[model samples]
Target: MASSSSSSSSLNFTVRRCEPELVPPAIPTPHEVKLLSDIDDQDGLRFHVPMVQIYRKKESMAEKDPVQVIRQALSQTLVFYYPFAGRLREGPHRKLMVDCTGEGVMFIEADADVTLDQFGDSLQPPFPCYQELQYEVPGSQEITNTPLLLVQVTRLKCGGFFLAIRLNHTMCDGPGYQQFLSAWAEMARGATKPSIAPVWRRELLMARDPPRITCNHREYEQVPDTVKGTVTPNQDDMVQRSFFFGPLDIAALRRLIPQHLRHCTTFDLITACLWRCRTKALQIEADEDVRMMCVVNARGQFNSPLPVGYYGNGFAYPAAVTTAGKLCGKPFGYAVELINKVKGEMTEEYLQSVADLMVMKGRCLFTTVRSCIVSHLARFNIREVDFGWGEGVYAGVAQAGGGSFPGISFFCSAKNGKGEEGIVFPICLPAAAMERFSQEFNHMLRNKNQPQTTSATLIMSNL
Candidate 1:
């Protein structure tokens, strides 16, 4: 993990947790082994992903106990989403499958001394008291033979509460996980079933017989253990901070773009800015390679569209590589174009080729060599989850980021008290580099009054 993360330290506190317990499906599920799609058990995604959601009490929910309601709802919801109740097991050749043991998922009920408002007005990532809010049971940390999901509901003094959940990555991707969450919320509202039933056709993504490696997957290149130009810092030296971009901030970025290249999306522009600014902050050697990746969800990007309810790791991170100096020195459009090209290349052929590459290379890890990966969770409808307590003030990854590798971030949808929707993402780096990064970032978010180049001027002109 990255040396340090932003903790909910503003108001120091701890949670009083009851003994954790497993909640099984309301009804028995099929007892059988289900082979996961090759993409599901890949080396890059074999860990648990945690999320934190904050629900402000609504008048209608004043009398109801959210913990009790949600606990029952999860049990009922698991009957339909039973795969999540099963444990992951290794088959021959290191392939993974669900044991369908019906062991159920872990759940905890806890209470906190602080009120939700006391935590802070802004409920976003890098939240305070992260470990306490998202408690993990001991002996339940392994990737296999453990509950696929662990949930903790911490009640606050003000009626508003927190819902924290940790899920195994191989079981689902962002969209799939969100889908399951929506179902759980629906059940909490007394729905007989999920609006869209899940489809477990993992076989749909099976690797082609006689797997063939077609494209040069530079993102997975086997390089020296010590990667170049990465924004790595000592454990005690890192600072995690989140940046927000609203309509006005985005307009500022767009104005810098040339008309022809204005077609670039918010994703492209922001990613371009972050890569450039981050590269400059690192002050990496001019000749060393620096890579920026955009994680593209392949739901419909493949030859055949994945079914509406299909939930698995159906995604890929295509990298845009260049020298640190080149990326930092290039016009903003250059970086945007690089990102668009790699993202556009994620067609059916590209996905299939990746599946083949995975098996062929013994499921290699994504290149950690000076690589920065950014993903957007807005499309996943993370905030739409309403567990009968009205919508949550915040709903997204528990921690914006800190992974085995450095340079990880997530762009999530957020709204203020005024209901102004915007994008917020968190990134962690050394204290000194963070200062430099913030300086460069402010320039990118420049207003008309701030004298500056548009896309840094020459940056987007070529695209």
Candidate 2:
């Protein structure tokens, strides 16, 4: 094992690359092929998703070295997910493709000198400490040189361990990647085969012709092109916070909406509250059109749903746009209506139309300064991943860097050491706006006469 020390007093770790093992047998012909769908082409070329999960000490895990178990399972799992061991190459048409050269995924082993409790309750630590746990692939900007996935395992002094993962978004979406992780965990637990085998039929998402524009696509047109140049606040001027909402809080939000809309799902209600609070926090011009960009899974929206194991970008980007003043001034039900309207509009024809539009434009939709992107992961089996040690105490997405666009939040399930059920929001905002956002968010929870919000606050304060 390799070790390095950190300057921070909180946590320190040393990292070293583990020996690489190729998955498939070497052959004269390499598995080189283009991606199934061009939808991924619109994604930022160099952007990757980073996640960290902490597993507390367990007797079963302590008896067997977690590193060895993870290594053995990962190597075996890659046999099926071989494309992860390959490099990204440009096809003849300048599109990206996976060149299955069997270079192998990057694996790093680290020794953390701190205990799990000492690392704190929030899974996300400061960037310095968090970055060390994740493996950074060299030459990440160069497609051909970058590995599709990187894994880091850090063993803590308390017997607990942290698994940091970095995966190229171009290769797969959240659900697809989660499936891979779940399968790997199953292997680590000694399963001979994964319960769900991944299917790589990307061509199934290809666009159709006549370029149908079946409903209004004003959402895409509403996104400003100048968003790429929008300024990001300095790290010192930014604050990241996590807020939890229990069943009571959710019910209260539903009550705020009209009876007609009360039937909306819990996700719709919570997202509406977030949109309203965030809009108020920013205090943008009343006339300014603020939008909430949401990612909708398109797998089941098709007339004939995609396979359960379909590992591709089976998602759509839909936005709910309204003036900041309208959002802040209207009753909570208004925001819910806007969101539900967009959700309801996502029919089979609508999704197909969006695909056709993207194919025609040869680009992906972009968000603007007025846009706040939100992702819901509460339904994903994030807390269910077990590597023989036990279920993770905390598992969620980690920020890529210190700075990010003003408003980005991920809603996931929360396990606060207690047997309570709640939803947690990992949010990033400008420091100047966090205080107000927190106040507004808490106000809604407390006004619901919910006691769980108090517990949620205590949990966050400990972090």
Instruction: Find the candidate with the highest TM-score and give its number.
Output: 1
Across 144-173, the per-residue lDDT of candidate 1 in tens digits comes to: 899999999988888989999988888998
Candidate 2 lDDT by residue in tens digits, 105-195: 7777777677777655545433345656774545653445577777788887889888887777777877887898898999998897789
Give residue 364's error in model 2 in angstroms: 3.3
- Candidate 1 regions off by >4 Å? 1-9, 225-228, 231-234, 402-404, 416-419, 448-463
Worst 10 residues of 1 by lDDT: 454-463
TM-score of 2: 0.87
CA lDDT, every prediction?
0.79, 0.69
Q: How many residue pairs clash in each candidate?
A: 10, 3
Which runs of model 2 end up more than 4 angstroms from their true locations?
A: 1-4, 7-30, 44-46, 92-94, 124-128, 141-144, 210-213, 222-236, 400-406, 417-419, 448-453, 458-463
Q: Clashing residue pairs, candidate 2?
A: 3-14, 4-14, 36-202
